[model samples]
Target: MTTAPLASNSSPASVAEMEQSLEQLKVANYYLRVALDQVTDGVVIVESEPSDPKCGPKVLFSNAAAAMLAGADPETGLRGLGLNDLVAGDKDATTLQASLQQAVQNGGCHECECALQSLRTQAPIPCKWRVRAVFNSLRKLLNFTILISPAQPNAPAKADPKPAVEDLDAQSVQLRKENLAALAQGIAHDVNNLLGPVTVRLSALIQQVQEHPALAHELQAVFAGLKRAKQFTSQVVTASKAVPRKHEPTDLSALMRDTVEFAGAGSNVHVCVRQDDNLRLALADPVKLSQVLQNLVMNGIQAMPRGGYMDVEAHNHMVGGTGDGRLKPGPHVLLVVRDRGCGIARENLGRLFRESFTTKADGNGIGLTTCKRFIDEMGGEIRVTSTPNVGTEFRVYLPAAEGSGSTKPLSPADAAPVPLKHGKGKVLIVDDEDDLRKVANMILTRCGYEVVQCDNGQDAVKIYQSLFRTGTPPDVVLMDLTLRGGMNGTETAAEILHLDPEARIVCTSGSVTQEVQMVFLERGFVGVLPKPYEAGELTQTVHRVATMMKRN
Candidate 1:
């Protein structure tokens, strides 16, 4: 018998076309492999050698999903892996082998269920398998394609209805914390607005009562009290909003005095601060450190239901290499707070700084944790010592400012107050609060400047436009962020700038976050003045802006 040569009559041009077609098939196969690798379902092709009984089916090719399901390295994939390696037990392996054989014999797909064992974990995961035989046109077997998928659980045991206890508690704590932060922010805003007018009016009163020493002293005390209240509100905003800290050379002596006074304002605790004459300055964030100090002081006050004395002392010290592992050895400022109150129990001392651990019935257990976090961030350490029913002492060590010597410096309050700036320029004060507008008007008028007032954004726009029409627009405009109607401060500023491109507008708000300040500044505002500001700060900012406008 003679066999006819294949393609004996084929032309050269046909051979070229066939080569191009083969290249296209290769490109198509590459894309198909890429697509399969992207899918989540595991695809594994196993080659069977029925002619050789010793060589069973082995993995011909596998995608990423298959390698992951088998817990094998992606680089090695599942190539050369035997069928038995993928199955968990002998029974499952036998069943899979039978399904493959049936698929080959019938030339149809076969389905079965088995568990795939992970090579790394050696753990069995229940999965469904679909076997399809691949063959050439002549019916010559190529490979068996298997699709592996996670098995669907029986209806009676599908899922666990109850969540884990730890997960539920964590979620509850997080929700409560978020709610508390929101509440604190709201309260701080309202309190700042309420305190704004009082702070301004008290400054004016203090200036007016300078002729009477007795009255002046009393008014000064009240003014100091108001200042402390404002600081407390700032601390509230800082704690709740998680404001980024701005570190500077801080006067620790002054901060301790102010914090102790503010924390013991309404309580029966008497806080006495003793400081070294030559205490060094601390390189720290003033607001955050003040918050920490206030928390400790308040905790001390709360510990003593009855009236008692607490001592706060500050001095400079040098840390050595053998101290606590966390702190770096360097010049340090040590602040010690001691209180004679119902002390903490000995058994609970180790967990004093642990998160969500508290002894008080009404405590949320975040105060000490926050305090420790703040101190740690400032490159400091805070330690506690307590004896049951005796007393408790907290020692805080802060890194000293670079190049700061032992010469005593004045605190912010102890420093001489700058004289209120006197300038002659037309000013417009716009605010929704009646008392705020009135206080600003009085203060500016006393400083020898003509002042105009408006309650809402609409009137503010009208007044500014009218002034501009008359060729005598106000030199500076203080725009309140929150207005009763029409437009807010930002919108009003935009309208004013539309009428006059060179409008000198200042943004004022009780809640002037960093984002808010940046937004207003980008919109061409000249300055930002946070609410509850001192009279000196208000006059200084306004005078500076008005003068700059004239200079231009």
Candidate 2:
């Protein structure tokens, strides 16, 4: 009866259905292989022999990632490889085997960090592994599914030589200084952006009121105050840098007289400058050196609130012969600021240049520190001598230029404004800042030029292409270096140049570093107009570029 029942169960339709089911399983397996290959981490499976579960474990399957990790052909997989082939040494293999056995006994999951040797490279690769064991209903060991990921290499142990407390303290202090300097730099960048419009508009106003004598005088005074404020912001920026800006030979005596007059303008302190006509020019950043002199003179003036005279003297010195160890062995220009006022105490003299350490009730203490930093950056030295109830003197020794003469310092006289050349073509302005664009539009439109504006580089490029195609290419394009949510100024400039080889593009940015400026120039920019540019600067830069384009 059992034989007859078995024979009746196999119809043609049922056999066809069984065949279809087997085909579906094969398709599923193919899809699974595709999915596993797409993963980035390695996946592998190993099967253990039923009779010798502890010793004979062989690779049954491996995905493409796993094969690549093992340095094998992905199509061939890592099948038929023993556990010993993957692990670095006999000890590692034994450890892996034990871990597998433990996982099988305790519900089939284990994780470990191990070194696996690459078959092709023959180098040990550190890896983290998570292994899961599959089991039958009878609790027999079957196979292991492993996920392998590259692990960070362990740092080597060092000999136990305890570091000194003083070394640790110094490290901490240095780190703190670095962090503070970084913060100060970020603040300075933002402040510069905010001050840009004010500085430019103030210059514009001052230029406009020149016909009104009284009004011009008042605006000039305000402009001077703003200039001083701008200097302070620049000082903040310099405090964050390890080195000063580029140095050129500058007349130390002329700079000293200007700083003394500026510092003692409203104070009762009568400042007098004394220097020889043959004083050699000092190699320094003119602006930074001026700021240092101003700081010293201001300190001197503040020390004498009861109206006293301060002397500023400049002279030549042979460094080693000046009786100052801080000055190197070379020719130097010595500038001294002497004030007859209550001098610094002996105990506080050593800490005078330390930031945030001051004796005055109203002092923030960064003045002397900043002066010291600036002097050091110029490859110079600053020293002080003080006697209680007598006077305090600050001396700065800067390296003297080798040559007898120097280039005249940049001044308004040197940068005499170029007359606006009225143009017949359209001007395009691309910037993300709305206020800045508006300011630019006002200036360009007032100068008898048609102005177009865009807030991003992509739109600017599109507009430029459209204009070029229509046979009305812009006479000049003012581009901002950075734009949010689109292509940057450099990319846009390149695109525009592709559209029109003779396009005149001037790059602008508030935070334009020297490197960025160089990149802009290399990318076919006609000129670079730094942000917060005055109306005259913008017009002058545009006019120059446009005139060049016309000539070309």
Candidate 3:
């Protein structure tokens, strides 16, 4: 009944048939690869060993098109590249990974849209991605097949093309803004590091030159310029990160000057800024206020493309009564941006601040709307007055800061510099910037503090650990969020806390996002010191943090 086990099929005919089947399989695999390479859509194969799912999926193979799409060399393909390496942001990468895992378990094709990081330019390219799970005959998971294609925007119906044009125009402008934001974020860290030392040094120089009035005045001007540069960088980061708005006493005169100068730079437009001798500080978000001013000034410049004069004026005003519904009764800082250009039509004046309402042929009409929204959020008012072919004017009224806090327009004679706070404590400074460390050391040393400096996080941890072992841990550890290599500031802080949980660490970074600061605080950091800080601020922060630690 055993059937003789198929008569032991090792004969010459059987061997020949087996060789033929093996040859056919080789031919089929070669053809499949060629077909994948010839397709327009990108094809990538991802696989993970069943025994080691924790290792996740590795890029097993990619066709020519896939290589091109992923910004890899066609000959080399994208094999062995980490999954996260293909996605642009951390959030997006996590989402894609989750989707892949779901597809593996649920047995269906999963789709998502995400920006892919291009290896050649290191730019983000938006794409539509799909993942399908592959399984063996036993239903055990084997691998995944991924298809990538460029993302296409949904268009409006063909009846009315105006909406489509407006949509495209808006998309174009948004794309440009995103690109600029990315560029700004990329350079902000380096720029802040470069400016931090100069800022601290300038503060010290001004104090040193106070004996000579004229010399101090000259130094004050340089310091003012440095502040403007820092403010610009901060505004860029604020916009890109979309941090929460903060209202504080703002020097509107300085913002006006900076915006007018920036908007008119290299342009034929003539811009003049005027401020009252006793202009009061405004209670507003300095970053958003700067943005609003920039938008208005830029609009004025564009209005007069053939070269014309624009006036930007800031003054203190008192509203005794709430006569109109537009503004509340209070002290206000009145800002005027006037342009001698082709004005809007009388009928369109009311719609100036309306969303997506544009008078220009190519305008998407979001600038004025955003300005209005931001002004309103700050308890302010914005009004527009225009006459066709005559001129146009934009008026912004911001709530004046409490008290008699009038800001003088960059007058060194009226500006009395704040003295640096003296402190006695040991501080461990971790930063990669050499000049910055030198300046920090100089400032802290003069203020009666012992300072130890290190370039990277590895050394930083080691120094702190040794200090702790010797029973003389630094009273305050100033940790920079970004380091050139090895562990970052957060990771270093974690390691230090692991060694000594009661360590008082302060997070210093160019990024001032509320979310980022909160994360650091929750991770056992006691304080935060933003970069590009003056000597006074640095000394004050260190003193306060050290004093608190001693109290604890």
TM-score order, best first, reads: 1, 2, 3
Candidate 3: tens digits of C-alpha lDDT, residues 331-439: 8889999999999888888888899999779999999999999999998999989887878999999889888556765644433345699989999999888889888
Point out the worst 10-residue segment of candidate 3 by lDDT. 48-57
Tell me the tens digit of each residue's lDDT in model 2 across 1-552. Answer: 345443466989988888789667856765787788788788888885533444347887787677666655333457768766788887778777777877787799988877777664445666787888888898876789889876643443365324444444544454345446555655765676676667666666776766898886666556565555656666565545443467778787657755665678889989888886678889887778888888889888878889899899988877665456666677788899999998999999999999899898988999889889888988899999999888999999898998754435435332222234455558899988787788778767877789999998778988999988888889899998666543567768889998888999998865454534675677799888865566778787877777784723
Query: Candidate 1 versus the native: TM-score?
Result: 0.64
Once model 1 is optimally superposed onto the true structure by TM-score, how far is the C-alpha of residue 179 displaced, in angstroms? Answer: 7.0
Over the stretch 1-552, how does candidate 1's per-residue lDDT look in tens digits?
A: 899775877899988898789667856765787788888789998885643333358887888678766665443468777888788988998899899989988876899999888664534777889999989998988889999976665434236634444444544454345446656766887899999998887776677777998887667667766776776677676656555556688888777866776678888888989888878889898877888888998998888999899999888989898876677888889889899999998899999899999999999899999999989989999999998788999999999999986645655446223357888899999899998888888888989889999987767888999999999999999988777544567778889999998889998877665544776788889999888876777888889899885624
- Give candidates' CA RMSD values in order: 21.0, 16.6, 14.0
Task: Work out how many backbone clashes candidate 2 has.
Answer: 0
- Candidate 3 or 2, higher TM-score: 2
Number of the top TM-score candidate: 1
Q: How does residue 369 of candidate 3 score in lDDT? A: 94
Between prediction 2 and prediction 3, which has the larger lDDT?
3
- Report lDDT (Cα) of residue 204, candidate 3: 80
